[model samples]
Target: MGNGTRLGRVRGLGSAHEGAGEWWKHKVSSGSNLLLTLWLMVSVALLPAYDFATIAGWIAQPLVAVPLILLVLSVTHHFRHGLQVVIEDYQHDESRFVLIVLLEYFTITVRVLAIFSILKIAFTTTGVAA
Candidate 1:
């Protein structure tokens, strides 16, 4: 109702569907990913070897275990957001959209399962030491 022009008034206003909120979430997630990636690199360096037992030993340490678990969770969440954006953009047809949705769900499920498995392995190793 003020004297602002139509385009000027609408310039910064985002979609009604919460696109701005999603963008903010993406920024936060990306920041967390940056930190997590650094921790993951250090974790990999601490491993004695590529063998299962050696890797398990490294992961069982509280210093590595906790951050790796958090990294897994945060990275998966960030990846899901990216995949959703891609799905929204590149998927046009109804059938293709349905396929992309299914693929996204499957990807998320697999990622969560892998994270749980890694946590389980780490904790089991920790328990074995006690």
Candidate 2:
């Protein structure tokens, strides 16, 4: 419950109790990102061609689109968590909060755009046919 024999323990001042959860999340996201990225690479490598329409049509399938979206989510989550750790560890200036805010906003915006593009491709062409 306490860190070492620091006197802050008796005064009820100690760890914030948030690091473990954050660490777990980073690990989970990292694992998912690895698997999803490999899936993406294999899927693309097996494609007949890398042309735009061909790629878009491939993404049009629900099976492909869902995993692609998941990849985006996992990558962005990993990205933000990694950067936030850097900012938290090295950024001691007053602007740290601002940087964190900007990081969150950037991550959210990227996630939204990526998901939108995938969904747009997935829903185009036909409702049931890819």
- Enumerate clash totals for all models, in the order shown: 0, 0
TM-score, candidate number 2:
0.82
Q: List the residue pairs that clash in candidate 1.
A: none
User: For every model shown, what is its TM-score relative to the native structure?
Assistant: 0.73, 0.82
Give the alpha carbon lDDT tens digit for every residue of 63-84 in model 2.
Answer: 8999999999999999998999
Tell me each candidate's RMSD, in Å, in order. Answer: 6.5, 4.4
In model 2, the Cα lDDT at residue 9 comes to 55
**lDDT, candidates in the order shown:** 0.73, 0.86
What residue runs in model 2 are displaced by over 4 Å at the alpha carbon?
A: 1-15, 126-130
Candidate 2 residue-wise lDDT at 119:
92
